[model samples]
Target chain A: MANLKNNRYLKLFTSTFKLSACTFGGGFVIIPLMRKKFVQELEWIEEQEMLDLTAIAQSSPGAIAVNASILVGYHVAGVLGALVTVVGTVLPPLIIISIISLFYKAFRDNPIVSMAMAGMLCGVAAVIFDVVIDMAKVVFKKKRLLPLLVLIGAFIAVRFYAVNILIIILVCGVIGAIDTVVHEKKGAEVK
Target chain B: MIYLELFWSFFQIGLFSIGGGYAAMPLIQNQVVDVHPWLTMTQFADIMTIAEMTPGPIAINGATFVGIQVAGFPGAVIATLGCIFPSCVIVMTLAYIYYRYRGLNMVQGILAGLRPAVIAMIASAGISLLIMALYGQRSLPSDLKQFDAIALFISITAFIILRKFKPHPLWVMAGSGLAGIILYTLI
Candidate 1:
């Protein structure tokens, strides 16, 4: 809501860029880092806003980091903020990928590098696990049955039927929307 | 023509995919494997494996690797750009509207529904990863396939132990890589 240059835009942008470059696992890994810098250090955004944006970004499409940047940018200073945040987020991966590609053969099978990558993989799985658990507690509310059934359906589709993912998302979206609308109508009627 | 196709394909992936790269995995596999046939499923699986082993998001790696294979360096560039474009537009748009309607209950409620769905998708993915890791466990050939079980065990145990310890994740991964090498040579 203020002029970009005078405020903390540059600092926030650089911090996110570095996080993007360094973070191996996408989604949750980059998210906590972004929260640390934007929400915590600079106070650019609040905690609730971060959670809300995560929901929006997940549903919207595109790289989580990019969508997130746009949301944070939009929330912070409007159109210009969105532009700066995206540029900041893109710069890291763009630069790093270019460097990696240029030296691809040389680094492709380096043992130490390979070992480091192996470590990153374990960390990634753990990072994603943390995200799944934290969000599950909030969303599913420790439900005993319905959420478990939904989880079972998804696993069956992925493992047994080998169903197309888009189909799964479509079904879930429709079901979720119906549940939300019906519940809302019931609430309004009670009032 | 080639560059345009590369861009459009990833653009489509970006425009529709949510919950990040992991969620996009199945559709991406389809685009490259079934629809386009630019890469075989085996190669695609291998790419997924490598992507996991490397840095950055899964979709980005998919775009980069698939694009390079199809149309060389330029293809990778366009595809990556296409992949992130939707986020740029959508996030900025939402940010603008979110200000005026910050306290709308309906918006908040829709989010509540969507949250559970996203978690479900992540759960399914975790199961898929477990299956992949657990593959060699079931079909072990007495002594020949023991390495597979070891990796799985290390992954599971390291996952548990590392959760409590404050050491960097890279250390755990590097240790596994060493284990992979040692297992490979000795076994």
Candidate 2:
């Protein structure tokens, strides 16, 4: 039992570190990878928890990868687990950026390389679309009309008006809070 | 120097722009392309691809690429760090808050709003990429049929299949690559 517990911690540390190191394209890219590891590989967390963790990860601020590591870490081994996971995740960027601090001048306007990179953006966009469709299936399955409408509203805002998203986030947050409070009060009275 | 600006800008992207990577793109475009004009639209588009392909945050990769463009190595360093700083600070703060209000409704409600916004963000990201791609192909002769329709079609088809089948995504990826090669050769 003791050895197994120790192994979990070790596993947690290594995985989180690897996640942080290899999480290219921001934290969104890690979603599938994390699912494979936590839901399929280690089976430490259930599928629902992975789903729930994604929502929780996004609703809060900061990087998705960091928040995810913290949640998965804490879920696996408590506060210390969260600490190790976060440390592992952040370490690679720290080292890379530190090295980059010295030699930043040579990289700008490298045309041949930039052109190759252009070819890859299309692939990235396609992958991001895949993630969205997956999330949409989840949210829609709940029969959550209000959320569906809100997403449509946000889409219109971005597509048509090109509105600043921060404003929309604020508006939605306020509206959601009001609804929750009103519902809670109504339930209190009805009971 | 200018690298400092790139760092602070990306750090801001990392910190405040919530949701996820897709959500981060517009905010990045606003800063690097729209606000600063540090990079042309096509150049920025290419950097985005590089960012997506690499490990770590897409925004971080963008920061590094853009920062490198504006200033070089120091610029990339500053940009990458800047992009990361916001997330580091915000996530750490949230970690504290998450423990304090693990069961709070206010937190839950805020999340509720964000859920929809996130979907929207992701959708917009896809659209933005398409717009950029079409624009890139626009200047060519009208009859050229320049878009990589095959790649787009296959990628989406593969994604839908993977989603429906609930199999290993890597298999889908491998199959898509092979399919792509065959289609290209035949064409």
Candidate 3:
């Protein structure tokens, strides 16, 4: 039993570390890779369970990759598993960024590097724009008035009013909670 | 004290940065750029470019990069810890609750509500970045002469390619870099 537990922990750590180190494009990319590793390969988690955990990971705070790892780790081996997974997931980025940072000054000052960054900045903006459009489309597909209002209202608050981002997030969360409660009550009354 | 500050800043970013890595952009920008003045807008854009190319969450990458720029390797370690600390606590508790209760309506509702707001936040970040890329400034320039037409052309072409073809983002970034070299350097 002890050996099995140790083996599971080791596997969890290594799997996450490998995924984090190799995968690019962040959470959306990593989550599918994780599902492949844990579900199809290891059979540690069921497909449905992985899906549920993914939804939870997406909804919760922090990086979805880290959150998903924490949930999976805990599911497999409890608290210690969660700790191990989180460390594994974080290590790759930390190591890679630290190495890049060492040479950042050189890159920043090089005229060639600066021009490339300038062009890459445009690419970055395009990618961010794509994200905005994609996410907004999902919200719009629901056809809800409150969501549309919140979307426009939040954008205006941040862009023009300069309201704090933290405040905006908190207020949105509260509004969402209240909206859910009120709808649930209506459903209950009808039923 | 600086280490403490780095830790706290990234901790808050982790705690509030809901949705995902892209959604975290505005929050990261607010802290490292607006609040602390640790990085300029262009430098922040460079970090975002690097984050997209790298193999990890942008939030983690951003924290590590900013920490290194502001301090050193120790700073990078501390900032990365601060960023993931919230994930460790929040995800574990939420996972426990999820298993205990099974279906969670409140979580679903809250996510639904947040969806639009998250989109808005992402849009806000994109707009600022667009302004920076086109005008070479944090905000729009009063005079049109400050605008970089070549940058605008690159961005529009990139946006069209992304929307139409949907190639991997790496290709778009690499193409842009090559374009930059040819247009800005070689020309």
Per-candidate DockQ versus the true complex? Answer: 0.32, 0.28, 0.43
Clash pairs, candidate 3, are none
What is the C-alpha lDDT profile of model 2 across B105-180, one tens digit per residue? Answer: 9867766766777677667756665444334431334654666776566656765775677665444544654565
Give the DockQ ranking, best first.
Answer: 3, 1, 2
Q: Can you write out model 3's per-residue Cα lDDT over A1-191, one digit (the tens) per residue?
A: 99998999999999999878755544754554675588778999875466557656766789988998999999999999999999999999999888887776565557886787678777767776765675567667887899999999989998899776667767877887899899999999999
Docking class of 2: acceptable
TM-score of chain B of each: 0.63, 0.58, 0.58
Q: Write the per-residue lDDT of candidate 1 for residues B8-95, one digit (tens) a residue.
A: 8888888878666767898788788887878888778767765655556677777887877888767787888888777677766776
- Which candidate number would show the highest DockQ if scored against the true structure? 3
**How accurate locally is residue B89 in candidate 2, as Cα lDDT from 0 to 100?**
52
| Model 3, runs deviating above 4 Å | A1-93, A100-104, A188-191, B1-83, B94-102
Give TM-score, chain B, model 1: 0.63
Error of 2 at A52 (Å): 6.6
Query: Of the candidates numbered 1 and 3, which has the greater TM-score value?
Result: 1
For candidate 2, give the DockQ.
Answer: 0.28
How displaced is residue A53 in candidate 3, in Å?
10
lDDT of each: 0.64, 0.66, 0.80
Q: What is the TM-score of chain A in candidate 3?
A: 0.57
Instruction: Flag regions of model 2 displaced more than 4 Å.
Output: A1-6, A13-27, A39-134, B1-49, B62-86, B126-146, B174-186
